[model samples]
Target: MTTSVRGDQLARLLGRWHALPGRRRSPDYAALAAAVRGLLTDGRLALGVRLPAERELAEALAISRTTVSAAYRALRETGHLTSRRGAGSWTTLPHGHRVASSGLWAPDDDLDMIDLGVAASAAPVELVHAARAAADDLPRYLGSSGYHPIGLPELRAAVADGYTARGVPTSAEQILITSGTQQALDLVLRLSVPAGAPVLVETPTYPNALAALAARRARISTHGLDIDHGWDGEMLLGALRQTRPRMAYLIPEFHNPTGHLMPAELRERLVATAHSTGTELIVDEAFVDLPLDDPAMPPPVAVFDRHSRVTSIGGMSKPYWGGLRIGWVRASAPLVQRLAAIRVGVDMASPVLEQLVAVHLLRQSADIVAARRAQLRFRRDALVEALRDQLPEWRFRIPGGGVTLWAELDGPISSALSRAAEDVGVRLAPGPRFGLDGTLERFVRLPFTLAADDLTEAVRRLASVRHDLDHAARPTWRTPTVIA
Candidate 1:
């Protein structure tokens, strides 16, 4: 609850401030706002810590001071953060004072912010064509009431088949389609978590998940997943034993931000624990199908379960298009029915048009995944090479399956460096964006979702900032620990 000041205190508060991987330049305000909002919802930024001075931070980031000012002003208007003249800016609780909406555009016309926040790339051209073709069949469904809350039967069957093809045999009756993973998650939370009950979340889990659960007033307990070892079964078991949460949510395959896969052994153990504790396990496989290669990656945790204690969530967003928000949850038929009921009260049903489109896209799922993996691999390899060549001082864990790299920055400048990166028209997510105890302070998740040219330029700017900072701090290096 203590306010963070400048220096190390401020540095600690600025966790996960670095630019995300794959972007060649800064993203627009909306993208940047989305990233910041993620950090805020994840509790990465404490409720009230003063942000660095706008002008000073802009200089450190190497961009115009106006850009930093504008970013801060925009965030202020969103109720995510606030600023006072002499007191400085800090994150605000949602109920404190709502941020005034800053319209829908960035203050400057020329500012092209390349957001490294999301790890997804645009959907393939084939998917687009398929979508158009699917539209041609939509007229046939016009005869029905169009209030298909249970989702299109064809799409549901395809989703079920996709799971079966992946080793988890599931029927269409086990599937309840929602608009997207976001809606799917919301519906599940509604079906499971009671208001104010303890909900377990992996530390540094997806931020939007935090937003959804928190909005429902669920008490959250965070568990650790040491990126260095992937995920420690022992640590998770310890948290499970200690919290006895109503449910434990995880991203078992190609985890967000960290890009770690849950080991099979650990998955079995977790299932055992869940059975004993009566805790529901929600495994989000949004990124499971994203490895640049390796189509036959690890199986879903749901497949190893001895009981119906797991709910598997899949979406076309990450592997497809962000705008194509179609996702489904596979659980026991009874649970599926419950989720469907919950969905009706919230959104009624997934849009018929989008579901139809998903059905067509699913037909060529293998080919689409193949192309996506290849493109992502190229980008991922390029990003790794650039980082190795430019920032060798940093250590990183090369992720085998996802779009982001979990890196260990050589110095303790995670927070300061994030502010620095931001000043240079680069938006990054610092290490702590994925954790709570500040354990990921020296870590950063660099996504490989940008074009090669843009990736090169972004790395160049980041390297320059590190060089300048190192050069400026050289004279002070020789002084004694307390001599200055």
Candidate 2:
């Protein structure tokens, strides 16, 4: 069955579309067609999503049925939509069109191509041991249908204990396991955030989170995060109070790209602000286990959420390996059940085998985290030294703990740098990908997840690209496929 978006939902998502800044004066049908095309390009109107009937949408937008019919006809002519007499129209991407889902880290066969684009790590020996243990434990689940909409009991309890040990009170009933943090985030957005509802996020936050927000067609307000001075607590609180957003998504622990950890005082203030504003806080802690400099860890953001307004998402992707496909959400038992209910219509649940392995891995998390931190520290130092040696003009603060560095360039040529770096076999995640509407042009995310020597080589190649950029033609605008 086709997933259909209601006319009211479409109207909400397209708020002020007709009066958007810089939109040229055009006929109503033409403008409507252009807005729908923009949504497709932005990955907000997903491929295969059925559009509302022309009459229904016309009523929603207060436009004539003739105008809606013209708009639908225009979309069909441009190959953006398909229709049938009885079946409604659905969206499609033209040939060679790229969107958010195109970006994922696959093991590259080309040794010549160095992917600084993806921020992930190789699996350690512990994964192998865990898989074997899971295999031995598999028979116990063999008699069942292998469906676990919430998660396996063992993994949920282990995850709950982890939070409890980290100074947050949690129970297994509160944990909702997922395929990855991405899935957990998607599910929460579906359950909590309404279409066109205001949602607060960091200016240069995680790109995938931005993509998820787009997919949900959320109205996003942003707070800036500075590399030198972590967060502007005043600005964050102000946005919460003023916008009164339905939800706020934050990555305070080893924040992506910038890698600035939020201070305990700021987190406390943030929770209080959320409470006062009646806004739910969605805290992403995937990087919490990878502290490189041994900084005193702050309590999880959920600790201060006495009303259970905070939902914390954790996964084995960063601290362990992305290939594991195990992630979870910690919230009130009621919310967990709600997520599971919504999830049943989606994938139903993550694989039984993956959850079993996660149970074993979580049991040995302390050792796993220690090993990752040590390895990452060595690689981080190598990257820092190489950047200083090769490209002295590029400046960045070494992250306390995270897979990537948010480096500032002397000019707003990050997109150009990315294009040029590709010629020299280095793939980069340009700063614009992590920002709203092509902002953050003077920065780029450099992942230090590779081996120490490989990280050094990538920087050397980037230095060469900078030298070439000095003499090359000015670059044109292009939204490249995402990798993070």
- The residue pairs found clashing in candidate 2 are none
Which ranges of candidate 1 are over 4 A from the true structure?
A: 1-112, 293-296, 437-439, 469-484
Alpha carbon deviation, residue 258, candidate 1 (Å): 1.4
Query: Alpha carbon lDDT of residue 347, candidate 1?
Result: 71
Candidates' lDDT values, in order?
0.72, 0.85
Model 2, residue 73: C-alpha shift (Å): 26
lDDT of predicted model 1: 0.72
Tens digits of lDDT, candidate 2, 277-318: 899999999999999998999888887888888999989999
| Candidate 2: stretches off by over 4 Å | 1-108, 473-481
lDDT of 1 by residue, 1-484 (tens): 4475443443344434444331214443333444455445434554566767776665554556676677777787767677777778886654463323521112222255445655678878887788798889899999988887778888889999988988899999999898888788888898899899888898777767877787778899987767677677788888888888898889988788778888788888899998888899988889888875564566679888869999998899877787788988999999998888777788787778888888888888888888888888888888888988889998877777877877788765554455556555555666655654455666666778888766766777788887665433211000000000
